[model samples]
Target chain A: MQQRDNENRLSQEYTNSVLLNGTLQTPKWWPYLVSILGFFVVIGFVLFGIQIKYGLGVTGLNRPIYWGLYITTFVFWVGISHAGIMISAILRLTQAEWRRPVTRAAEILTIFSLATALVFPLIHAGRTWRIVYWLIPYDASRGIWPNIRSPLFMDPIAISTYLTGSTLFLFVALLPDLAVLRDRTTGFRKGFYTILALGWRGNPRQWKMQVVGGILLSALMLPIFVSVHSIVSWDFAVTTAVEGWHSTIFAPYFVIGAVHSGVSAVVTMMALMRWGWGWNEFIRPEHFDALARLLTVVATAWLGFTFLELLFALYGLDAPEIALREMQIFQYPWNMLFLTFLLTGYILPVPMWIFKRIRTNIALMFWSSILVNIGMWLERFLIIVPGLARRTPFVFTWEAYSPSWFEWYILFWSFCWVTLLMLIFSRVFPLVPLFEQKESEVFSDDIKIGRATVPTIFREEEE
Target chain B: MVAEKNRSWGMVIDTDKCNGCSGCVTACQVENNIPLNDQNKFERGRVMSWIRIERYWEGEFPNVKARFIPIMCQHCENAPCEPVCPVYATYHNNEGLNVQVYNRCVGTRYCANGCPYIVRMFNYWEPTWPEEIRNHLNPDVTIRSRGIMEKCSMCMQRIKRGERNAGDQLQDGEIKTACQEACTTGAITFGDLNDPESEVSILAKSDRKYSLMPQLNTNPNVVYLATVDPYKDKNLGEKAKTNEH
Candidate 1:
């Protein structure tokens, strides 16, 4: 009975520390960052407006190289969305106690990153206003239904399903925490939390149902996250007339790439949250270590897939593929750029992650994670542009593609948009999942093993 | 049958006779109201011609072999551009021409990127015609606005005009694309491939007649005759003698 009381006190202390941290006053830089983000967002909006007024000609997109930075960045952001929900769901399923503090940031990142990613396709569209034409069911009178066979059509269906699933999963997890905030807060905050809490008073039934709903949503979302990226890859892969894009292995290749970049994004976000908010006690080096290990595996797998794809294309010597592979190796700018992608995405990071010290080092892990994303972005660029440039087997007609400054600006603001949205999201909600974090405490016990005290997790069910 | 009325339009380009005058390119641009391609357009990889002529150099300068080949939309029986269009902006028509529905295009440009031929062009700029040029514009064709892809329709508008003028059916040699009409050396022949008597159908049977990128089996309607070489026999004779020795 005394042991139970002491445990309760420990849980209370943990809860108070996390909850009180959530209601921290907005930092001074918050407004400055938002304003800066606003300035750039307005600039993007202005550029888009001029683009609409003048046509896509305002951008450097032209013949033979029609899809450029817009499509590449679009794919990158969408791939990043895969990181959050997949990590949260898999870790939750495995009953990883360390996953508790990380889940909200990851899930919220997935939702907003997806929201940001969807905007690119619309922006990339030639007839932006008529984008709705694709969504409306094909009418027989018009002799068209949105081409069900097209991967572009599949994008909307997959992303929306994913967006909906992740949003619900996030809300379900937020409810109990919202109720806690409801009890502690007052005035406008109290009412806001009360309504969002959906009349929860920490009753046994509410917890039971919330747990059941979270499990169901997590189960539903894992496959969806997988399929969302696969569908995005098919948008390129099934454009099989292009050489680098014509591989059969693209779906799995892309799914792995998405997780790789996504985990990097998660690690970067976690590092930012940990130090920036002084929540180091809650989000420890162990989480970064775990993420780094996952990243190493993902990066190795990415390298393996890239090697297999290169070998298969080389073996077949299909004319378009042959020409592109030659360019990938021997061509001046692409050769150097491709090497950069290899170094950043795999070669450099893999060796660093093998050492426990480097993996646990927050700064090194953070930068490497950022580097992986940059390399992944380059990977997307190499996939779309070079393949499109050497589009045909006829050597004389082959063209080279490079993005214009116009495209670079849109891409620049897209990152800002993601960061800006994340910043705003911080103000409204706590970065850590208070309910899950507290519940996670119930499982840990420091058991003496050999010569040392080792922290261990206890599970009621093996699953 | 409805298919019978749908003529399978085909073209025969005799590369042997091509003088590389670029007449066909100019004619197509003029006839279709293509925007004036500036130096910047070429630098930016934005050349907008529906049919472009490619030049190949076979040897070093002193003993060089130069070959000129014109490429346009293949109008394949199994068109890669058709199924990839989410809005059905581009599709194979009853007349066996791959048509672009300009109004329907939302500018995804997947069709342009999907095409192995790289023949499709997008409207990066809203087309503007000078007053005098606007007067000469082909009234039968729609001036495509920004964000939509446009490409060779195999002179579908001219074919429609020819059929409409000819009362019922177009005579074998009556219809001509702008490119065919402008080729001074008679290098281009446009006709119905379904009609065995048509020149394209006859030329298609020749051993020398081959489509661009035939390995893809896109089954292009446009066929090309190999550019003949005067030194062919001498080169072969030397190679054969070497093998015998």
Candidate 2:
């Protein structure tokens, strides 16, 4: 028993050293990678500055096609943020043990992606400086309350609420880890972790409170998780003026699409985490296998929603709706994008994901997950731009949108910005939660039946 | 100041009389201080004309006849653009005008997306005028800065001025919108629809009158008198099939 305890302690020490490497001891490539991402992020901010100084004209926006790439990327990032709630909150409620290693990275992705998503509307606006009037209720003294009736108003409210909740959820899960960092570090790092740790002592009472807080937050956040994407979908769905936009299916369609893309993004992040940190033991093929199985189910459901949306769109047999769908599907460029969206969004990756070999292959999962995002981004683009570009009663205004290079650069910048934030976050916190890792180690056991031994995870029964 | 009066302002366009001259388009641009729609603007699909004359071909190219309909902000009673504006920059005013408060507009362009007529135009760039033509700009209208939405106020400046001139008992013919004033064929008529004696009110009651995209139920104040097509009956079957879709 004493020998077993020593072996367990040595294993825990190895786990701590490996997970805490970034915070405790810096990696050689960390600074270089951060600088490169930071350089691009700064350049993106400058380009945005130039865009603001000139006008929205710098982008490809026109009279009819008022929204383009910015809005598309906006919805894309919002969709990407569904990773956190899906992995941490939903899986926790369902008592999924494999969620232990990935919860932090997924939650961090949510926070950063959401922060990035919130910026698109302001920058996409004609008057970015004056967006405060739309955002704030400060003008109520003039008897003009910000139009609560506006979906635009609801968007900010819903998004900010989710951001706040996610941040709290992240921080709650982070407390024990922060306390660990505090004990291990010195000087400024120690001070930083000390304040953030909130006097977490690993006492029984504190652990109980932490667990209760996490569970409570997860339960509370489930509604917000559903509402955030639903509201985002409503922004497009409620607009009756756009041919393909006014749909009842948008809410469920967007939510499911978000999960498909978001989970894929998490898979992509997990593959990168495994490779980049060399955490082979922690984030294993089994984890990827579990995520792939979940994704196969998610991607299929999303495909169903996609077809259902199309079916309902065509159900009315409305001439304009048919014309829009035709241009979206049969026309030269849009048809190509539609094909690519279908291939990458579901057909290619989902089929590959069905096979256990591909599901367990890290390299294949990474590339496939990246493809899913590209397809998801195209899906949003296809929805937004085509609806605007559709033939109205006035043929004179029929025109196609081509995103400007500046818009493309800005889109590129958002990716870099999110990545930079993630890298910075990793430098401070373990991407994989340490406490959860230890818990998993403690909970893991092997049982023998006759000559066969099988691995199992067990938790203590609640009193 | 004009005494506040309950007036439902409206417009009636006689498509039969319109020669597709584009006089109203140019007149509205000048009157509203709309940015010069240069070739670059046209190519980019960002032209800022407050009103446009859409010409539709009625038949095969050999026997084709052009039908012109001047379209503008319908100033709908149930304006889709109004409620969607987060800043309340666009709203229905007491004078029955669909008012677009320029300064209040932060230009989310949500209102533009909501407008089925697609009348709302965003100032994609700051409005500029050559030094020689700078004085020609109408000082009565505010020069909309880049990044805000502007649309046909139905020449609200003129309506306010007309009301201020006429005081308590404003006459129907007193307010002539820029489009009406410039229309050489008497195609465009503007007046208070509340007055039964108004020319617009009488024209709006005509059997040929219709509103654009009536299925959307915008309930527009701008009424159009359908073109008196001589060949309409000859192609009735084709037209019916087209309408059925």
Best by lDDT: 2
Provide all candidates' interface root-mean-square deviations: 1.5, 0.8
As a TM-score, model 2 comes out at: 0.97
lDDT of each residue in A1-463, candidate 2, tens digit only: 1223532432777788889987787788889999999999999999999878888889989979998999999999999999999999999999998999999999999999999999999989989898888787677544678998888898898889899999999999999999999999999999999999999999999999999999999999999889999989988888877889999999999999999999999999999888788888889998999999999999999999999999999999999999999999999899999999999999889999889999999999999999999999999999999999889989777778899999999999999999999988999998999999989988987788789977688878989
Which pairs clash inside model 1? A138-A145
All candidates: CA RMSD (Å): 3.3, 2.2
lDDT of 1 by residue, A1-463 (tens): 1223454434555555554563546776678878999899889889888877888877767667888889999899999998777678888887767788889999888988899888888889988988888866667446668898899999988888988999898999889778777777779988999899899878899889999998888888878867998999888887758888888888888888999999899999989887777777678898888888878888888889888878878888666688888887679888898999998998888799999999889999888888899899999988888887774645545566666677899999898888888888787777788877667677777788888978777778857
DockQ result, candidate 1: 0.70
Q: Model 1 in CAPRI terms: which quality?
A: medium
lDDT of 2 at B206: 92
Q: Looking at candidate 1, what is the lDDT of residue B117?
A: 85
lDDT of 2 at A4: 35
